[model samples]
Structures are given as structure tokens and as C-alpha cells.
Target: MRTGGKLAWGFILLLGIVHWDFWLWSDRTLVFGFMPVGLFYQVCISIAAAIGWALVIKFAWPKDVERWADEGRDGGGEA
Candidate 1:
């Protein structure tokens, strides 16, 4: 795999590991006195995951898959 692919997979693995939030299990702090710290942290994680996936799509997208899709769009594939 290429460097970007490796980094994207590494980011995915990191997100998987971080999603457990075990370190926040005992925390009771609240943010803006409304959202719990853990909840806020998870929200941040969600945002990060969104941005990470966007980056993966932008930088690590599969050219072959895209080409196949384009072929179908251009009616170059078996009809």
C-alpha cells in the first residue's frame, strides 16, 4: 500500500481504539454546564472521524474503483 493508504488505515485504527473512551468512564465534568465531558469528547471524535474520512476519500481513493465507476457512467461496461 502507499503511504497515504497506510496513514489512512492507521487513522482508522486509531479512531477505532479511541472510540472506546475508557479514560473518560470515571469523569463527571461538564462542558458549558450542559454536555458532559465524555459526551463532548465523543462529539469531537465524531467531527474528527468525519474529517478523517473526508481526507481518506480525497487522498486515498481507489483509482481503479473510480475508473470502473466512470466506465459504467460512460456506458463502456457490459450493458
Candidate 2:
């Protein structure tokens, strides 16, 4: 795989790690006196997830899919 593919896979793994709930016990702590620490952490993870998805789309989108799209656009879909 290419570097971008590796990065995209690593980011996906990180997202899985983020939801493991190891910080569930830290809920008693408040961040900025508004939301619980666990919730805040999850929110940060959400943001990271969004960024990761964008990176995957930008860098790791499959070449085969693109080729198929182009073929269809060129009226090569009869087969």
C-alpha cells in the first residue's frame, strides 16, 4: 500500500481506539465547567474522526472507483 493508504488505515484504527471508553471513569471531571471530561474527549475524537475521513477521501479513495466512474462517463457501461 502507499503512504496515504497507511495513514488512512492508521487514522481509522485511532478512531476505534477513541471509542474504547477508557475515560468513562473520568466523567466526574468538568471541562471548562460545562461538559464532562469524557464527553469533551469524545467531542474531540469526533472532530478528529471528521478530519480523518476527509484525509481518507482525499488521499485514499480507491483508484478502481475513479476508473469505473470515468468509464461510465465515457459511455462504456454497456458491458
Candidate 3:
């Protein structure tokens, strides 16, 4: 899959897991929070941050993996 798709799926899975934890457990502080906002909200914010980071990296540093593969095919030393 493309980077964007992978990121979207990752975010969805993370959110789902967080949601499950928030609903299934009463004491979420140990896993998801240490502040006033509560565990679920804290984890939502964290997921947002991760999405932002993924976007930045995906858009800012996109490269062709095949280029690296081609370079390695010749040998391991600089020409």
C-alpha cells in the first residue's frame, strides 16, 4: 500500500484500540493518561500527533526505494 493508505490504516487501528481501552476499562490512567483530560482524550491527542508526524514525514521525505535497491545492486562501495 501507499504511504498515505498505510498511515490512515495505522491511525484507524490506533484509535480503535484506544477506544476499546477507554470503554472496557475503568482505570485507564495507567495506560492512557496522567492529567486532567482523562485517558481517552489524551490518547486521541497522541494519535493526532502521530498522524501529524506521519504526514510530515510522508510528504517531506518521499523517496523511491528502487533507487536505493539499484545502488546496492552494483556493490557496497562508492564508485
Candidate 4:
């Protein structure tokens, strides 16, 4: 894999690790005086995960497989 792909995968791994939020589990603080800190952290994590998946699709997805899948879709014979 390329360096950019590796970095993207690393970011996804970091997101996975941080999603646990063990430190925030017992916190009683409220964010913006409304949402709980833990809930806010989880919401941020959810957004990060969506962005991370998009990055993985852009960077880590196999180009050759993509080509293979598209080969037969253009009215071609054997893919």
C-alpha cells in the first residue's frame, strides 16, 4: 500500500481506539450546558467515522478490484 493509504488506515484505527471513550464514561459534565460530555464525544466520533470511511474508500480501496468490477459493465464481452 502507498504511504497515504497507510496513513488513512492508521487514522481509521485511531478512530476505532478512541471510540471506546472509557475516560468519558463516568464524566458528569455537560457540553453547552445541554448535551452530556460523553454524548458529545460520541457524536464527534460518529462524524469522524463517517469521514474516516470516506477516506478509506478514497485511499485504501483497491483500484484493481474497481477496474475488475467495472470491466463487464460497459457492454464488453469477458471481463
List CA RMSD, all candidates. Answer: 3.4, 3.7, 9.9, 3.7
* lDDT tens digits, residue span 1-79, model 3: 6777677667656665665445444543444334434555656768776875676566544477768767747566775
How much lDDT does candidate 3 score?
0.61
Q: Give per-residue CA lDDT, model 4, range 1-79, as digits (tens).
A: 8887898899999998999999988998999999999999999999998998888888888879878876758666664
TM-score of each candidate structure, all chains considered together: 0.77, 0.74, 0.32, 0.79
Clashing pairs in 2: none
Give the TM-score comparing model 2 with the true structure, all chains together: 0.74
For model 1, the stretches where C-alpha displacement exceeds 4 angstroms are 69-79
Residue 37 CA displacement from its true place in model 2, Å:
0.6
* Decreasing lDDT order of the candidates: 4, 1, 2, 3
Off by over 4 Å in 4: 70-79
Pick by TM-score: which candidate is best? 4
Estimate, for each residue in 1-79, the C-alpha lDDT of model 2 and write its tens digit.
Answer: 6898789879989899867877586467888998988888889889988989988887887869767866647555565
lDDT, residue 33, candidate 2: 96
How many angstroms is residue 18 displaced in model 1 relative to the true structure, after the best TM-score fit? 0.7
To one decimal, what is the Cα RMSD in angstroms of model 1 from the true structure?
3.4
User: What ranges in model 3 sit over 4 Å off?
Assistant: 1-36, 74-79
Better of 1 and 3 by lDDT: 1
Q: Which pairs clash in model 1?
A: none
List the candidate numbers ranked by TM-score, top first: 4, 1, 2, 3
How do the residues 22-74 of candidate 1 rate in per-residue lDDT, one tens digit apiece? 99998989999999999999999899899789878777887698667666485
